[model samples]
Target: MKNKLSKLYKIFLAVGMVFSMCFNTLGMSVVNAYDPSVPKEFTRVKNIKYPEWWGRKIPSIASWSTYSCKYDGKWAFCLEAEKKTPASGKYPAQVIENNENVRKLLYYGFGGPAAYGEFAADADLKTAICPDDPLTNDDIKYLLTHIFLSGAYSGQWKGFDENLFNQTFGSNYGTNIMNIYRRIISLPDPGNGVSWEGNKSGNRALFKASYDKTNKQQVTNTVKLNGASSAEVNIPLASNVTIHIAGTSATQTGGTAKVYGGQSFYFTAPCQNSPSNFVSDNICGNGCERFTALAIHDGGAGTQAQGTWNMDPDDARLYLNIE
Candidate 1:
């Protein structure tokens, strides 16, 4: 009788897959909106391909199942509250429209459940090579911040030593990562509406690329600084920002623009006489660069600012004050 029941379950699962495939072939799969209770960044994804390990590892923790998942118009993955071992095949999951339990799919809930559970079981980290326990607000912040930085600096991993972990991940990443984590996780205010930075409002100017939320494209913006001293500009984070100082001067000297967090620019103006002659200076970063503000310094005495500071699509631009 048990064998017969197991066979029947397999048959039903196969049939369900057939139906799901048919619906998808006809371009008629149900795409549900995200739950209002959770943060907006956590959207319901569909058609996430689960690996075999998902159903095979830690069977006691999670019940392995398969479901279609998509994220931001791309295929993605999802997890249940419990940790489950993975299998070789996909499984059909119930339609989870507007499900509040979906919040369990976050890092603390499923992604890092082993670490979370062990930490909760005892106030000690269990995972080797950088384990984090997401319990208190601070713990949660630490875990998410680590995730953000790990992803941001994935290629820069040194090794698996504890000291190396400290050296690799234990640096002040500043508000760039903080704001990004908050944007994604919506971390609660500490108290009295004060931010983690201990300020009334944790706000700062983020010179970001022209982004369109509707289509989710990092559209680049181009600006022409034709003898314009002071202006506001926005450009892509992955691109380089350049400034030009042209025309005759007493002697060519270098100037600096302070971006923030180890990002500064030293530009050299040309000491030429022609109006069309120009010299260029620029700063390059590891692609995730952002500037809270921009300021240009005068190279030296008797130096006149000329030429154009054109930030093309290929090259980024943010120049403020030519004098």
Candidate 2:
């Protein structure tokens, strides 16, 4: 069953690929709206899970599973959980999480029954790596793009100890997404390579390159990125928001007139510069159609990152226009 966790990794990889493609088709210079006040009707949580051996600061030999929720037209929840590594005195378990829309898949009850039974029977699974953020947009955003850095362990086993290929997950979970994102999106803060389009009326987003989220989105669009190389872009707004979108060669949508609100409006690429291209001077990169985050965290504690391997080093920012 440990090997099943690998499948989770593959599924997330495929989802990310589709996100990139949608961005390409949407074109650059799209609006980046962020309103923590308006919830995206989605939720996410992340962390690195280990066995009891991990609690005693010892080595653990176990497998794990992960979960993901698509909100804001992208990933709302992306969890990478490690299953219990079996041993004589070892234990195992998995938390039974709940969601509204998706049905409970029968095979998703427990990861390992060994230590989990004892631990859960005693106090609950050993670790929960719950998000530090409250139930808000910021918290949800952080849960999906973070990575577990400590998963890589380094120490001598005994007196004549040698190197090993193990790791420690995170604090509340595995790693602090803030540190992870700070490292990934810092280089190309002004992202512009991707080109895509968002049909406001259809409430759909289609990427043109690396990332894709057509299947996962619920309301708004989510632009995903690989923490290490790619850029992180998050856009959160209300359903009636005056939003705008465009690509390098995209055609205009509703002209320059204000659509949603009286003064607030949404215009396509043909009329103005890429709204995503805005960035700082020194730390900013020489890219187009990109934006940096104003703050680091997603309302919770650490930076708002979700997946175990998908945390961005920077606060993937999404710039937008209201008026």
Candidate 2 runs further than 4 Å off: 1-33, 43-63, 76-163, 166-187, 191-323
Each candidate structure's count of clashing pairs: 20, 79
**TM-score of every model versus the real structure:** 0.21, 0.21
Tens-digit lDDT string for candidate 1 (205-230): 11223334664433222222221122
> Which stretches of model 1 miss by more than 4 angstroms?
1-62, 66-68, 74-261, 266-317
lDDT of each: 0.26, 0.26
TM-score for candidate 2, please give it: 0.21
Root-mean-square deviation of Cα positions for candidate 2 versus the true structure, in angstroms: 22.8
| Predicted candidate 2 versus true structure: per-residue lDDT over 100-164, tens digit per residue | 10111111111111112212224322223223323323332222222221121111111111123
Name the lDDT of candidate 2: 0.26
